[model samples]
Target: MLIGEVARRSGVSTRMLRHYDSLGLVRPTGRTVGGYREYSEEDIRRIFHVESLRSLGLSLRQISRALADPAFAPASLVGDLIRRTEERLKREQELLDRLRAVDASAPFDWRGVLRIVELLHGLGSPDAARRQQTVLTPAEDAPVPAEVLAEAVLAEADPYVAGALRWALARAGADGVASLAAGVRSEHAEIRRRAVRALAELPGDEATAALADALGDSDPAVHRHAALALGARGTTTAVPTLVRMIVEGTNDVEAAEVLGTLAADPERTDRLMSALAAELAAPTADSAVRIRLAQALAEMPATSAHGLLRQLAHDEDRAVAAIASALVRAAEQRPQG
Candidate 1:
């Protein structure tokens, strides 16, 4: 067959085939007198085998070495890959555990308010501290009031004050949505994040929309919280934004969970299936995301995602592969009336 026909049949691009040939990976069986490459059935089998190995994460040099030896066992290669993958996952989990430990140790500190206010007021400068002393003192002989300096500190510490004020504002009315929305525009990112979470708890269309916009916040944790809040709303309108975040947002587990909710929409099942398939093929995708996608694919009716699930059943990621295999088995066992 021609290059186009081979690509169409094998799902491997023509350019990739040429590159493979250049590397002696899958050389064509014959060439026409006019110099056109012609591949045989054996060549197609070899190409599929190459794809299968590549999907299993074998490097070109490793693949070449394996192909050279007739005694090479694909199962043994898969075992090695699985061992390496587990080691990497173990390291990643260790790092995550350490970060969680650090976060847990440092609870919110109100003392930061004094430090930030002092820096903002230029109190670190010798002359500026002297000027503050003069301004703070009523007279050379008169004692300065502690209450006055405390009030000045509160005013200078705008971010901490704003957070406290917003919390207080939440109690101002039965509807916390409006007050939280106002705080979303606060100069402090932490305040905005808190406000977004607060608004998320309130039930309304306007509040949901505002929280959706908050998913684009500069802080990753804020964006993740926003996605979770929107997911909690569980409305159809939030689906589009959640779907967008699942596709383009950071590799956040919260966002992936939200995407799983959005995938429940019948109208989105096909698109979600396609995205899941692409994710299964992506080298850089998070394992958690891939597993979630596999689970999502498994939950759909047998007819909806059978082919994709079948492809994933052989994935190098054992967890995903097992899920896919179970899905495929369940699909096969379903009775046909």
Candidate 2:
């Protein structure tokens, strides 16, 4: 059969068939005198097998490798895919946890809209934002002009009102981020904090940087919210600012919480361990900060972190010593290289 006929029979696009051929995943059995491709029953079966593996979320590379290796069992391939899917699911769960944490800190009155905004922010995709907006703004309400509701929602401090504001913002697209950014400069600190937090969810480099700036806001609550927003987005640029706050600032507790999540990235393990070591070296470092940093380091699996944690087990503070001991015990359970 020709490529078009094979595509129609297999339900895979002609372009994809050609791509599969290029990858040596599936190839036609023969070619006509004029160079037109001709596939046989065997080719069709190979195409179906490729389609089945693709549907299971195996990448072309994985499928290619599996096809090349006679020793690769189907069950083993499926188990590998399942393991990758589970890892992705775990990452999604972590993002959800960060979103929930941000939602809890948002002003209660605007919790509903903030919750949606939090979810959208966590998604980090335009398509997801649009889908979420559709669910929050029902079809029946589509005809209602946004201006009519914006005034009412923004004027009140109720959670419902805040929710409405967030819904309207999602519907408004990029304008929402701009308007919210302006709102962050409001005279009211609470309003500024809430607006900043909402804007942090919006997509843009400017919005991310603005959230980082908000970390230095005089209000500890606002600063904390900024830290959470930056952490949720996985903005590594804000890590230096957060590290300083946790290591040397007054709001050490809140800063440490945010840094713990940020440092969960294995790439940042060295930086986190180094920072913790520096804090521990300071004789004047607050005991609470030392304990928090030690706890954060313990959660990481880096070898350097394990050494630091073992040393922390001997701290004078009983609570810090106990946490250190627990970390050492946890690390010991892992098989040695």
Candidate 3:
């Protein structure tokens, strides 16, 4: 086959085949009488081999080395190709994400788009200060999209930056609720915790509802955070979880404080006290758990907790008895409302 025929059959252009000849990557096995390039069957096979390697993202130089050196091992080269491909994919994915974020912003014009783009760059900056500034620097007149801030909140690893992101999301109000709600179901506990914390700061019935739903999260820490946030919002659904935290000794003090706030309501006083008392009564309630329960009970309205405190003052555990006794004495000396 001649060069033209070879190019036509192999799908490689004649110009490219001449360039391959110049590089000695593939040479014609023979020439026509007019001295035009002629390709033999064996030469055509080599051209197909080169094309096959190129399909795997191999550079012409590397392919040359591969075809020329029988001793060359493909393991190292293939590994490099894999790494390069992964890096390219990562860059492409990031670009796609940025584009999606921009599109989601639905900016009014080129200026708003530029601001969001610039803000995204700052958020993605490697420096923690820059990321925080990105969240803070956006003027109130042009708020960054809530979804963008929500995504940053989930991804931020730096404590200060995460806090700033959360503050910003809170101001975004219900706009971020959908993005954050999706995050609540993340398989990752860290992400779920972040999402919950952000939801906690937001001021709206929607944010409150999202936090309430997170009470059923499988991760103890996730549900615990959600419980604390819900308690502050006076969502009674958090009651059982708050009591469980006291029993489990996870953030028991804060849990008790929130419970105390909840207990201030006349109707809920008896119910909240009962929940704590029930935990104290549970067979699994260990000495430490009872002590936590006793401490939590003390945070309630003194009248509500006074009876339980009196009973616990003489309990079997010395530590529980001492603490409860002190609380009982204090309750006794308290002024009447």
Candidate 4:
């Protein structure tokens, strides 16, 4: 076939075919009477081979080496092409993410677009201080979007930076709560914990409800954090988890304090004491678990707690007995409320 026919059949432009000829990548094997280039069947086959290799992202130089060098191995070259393709895909995905974030911000002009881009760059900065500063300073009164802040909060490792991000997300309001809620169900324990903590800081019925829902998380740490936060917010659903925190000795002190706060209601006070007493008396309760329960009783007011401590003072476990006895005696000697 002639160059034009080859280009038309192969979907390659005539100009590109001529360029390939100049590079000696594919040269026609015959000539017309007018001295124009003429392609033989073998030459057309080689052109198709070059085009096939090019489809796999092979450079023209690499293709020349591949076609010319009989000793060339394709394994390493193909591996390199795979790696380069992956890198290009990654860059393109990042560009798409940036564009989405800018569009999500609903930028009013080029200035707003630039500001969102700059803020996003700062939020994703490797330096913790830069991330914190990005949250601290709004972009000319344009607050960072809640979804962006929620994403950062879930991945942030630096405690200080994470706190700043949480505070900013809270100020961003309920917009980020749904994103953080997804993090609560994450397979990663750390991410689940971070999500609950961020949700705790965000003010709204939605944030509180999300935290309350997390009370049943399979990860004890997650449910415990959620329980504590919800306890502070007066969510009655956290009561059982709070009691479990005491028994397991995970943040039991804070758990006891929140329980004490929650126990002020006469109805809740009765339930709190009943749960403590039952745990102390349960057949599965070990000495350590019983001791933790005894100690937790000390955090509540003497009116509701001292009665239980007195009964526990006579318990079988000597350590549990001693701790309960001490708490009771101290409660008695203190000034009356």
lDDT for 172 in candidate 4 is 76
lDDT of 4 at 279: 83
Worst 10 residues of 4 by lDDT: 137-146
How does residue 303 of candidate 3 score in lDDT? 79
**Candidate 2: Cα lDDT at 296:** 65
| Residues 148-183, model 1: lDDT tens digits | 222222233344443433333333322446546655
Tens digits of per-residue lDDT, candidate 2, 211-265, equal: 8777767776676677767876887665656666666655656556666666677
Q: What lDDT tens digits, residue by residue, belong to model 4 across residues 68-112?
A: 999999999999999999999998987897788778888788988
Better of 1 and 3 by lDDT: 3
> Clashing pairs in model 3?
none
Residue-level lDDT for 250 in candidate 3: 88
Weakest ten-residue segment in model 2 by summed lDDT: 141-150
Clashes of 2: 2
Shift of residue 263 alpha carbon in model 1, Å? 3.3
lDDT of 3 by residue, 32-117 (tens): 89987689889999999999999999999999999999999999999999999999999999899999998998888988888888
User: Which lDDT values do the candidates have, in the order given?
Assistant: 0.62, 0.66, 0.89, 0.88
By lDDT, rank the candidates, best first.
3, 4, 2, 1
TM-score between model 1 and native: 0.40
Question: In candidate 1, what residue range of length 10 has the lowest lDDT sum?
Answer: 142-151
- Better model by TM-score: candidate 2 vs candidate 4: 4
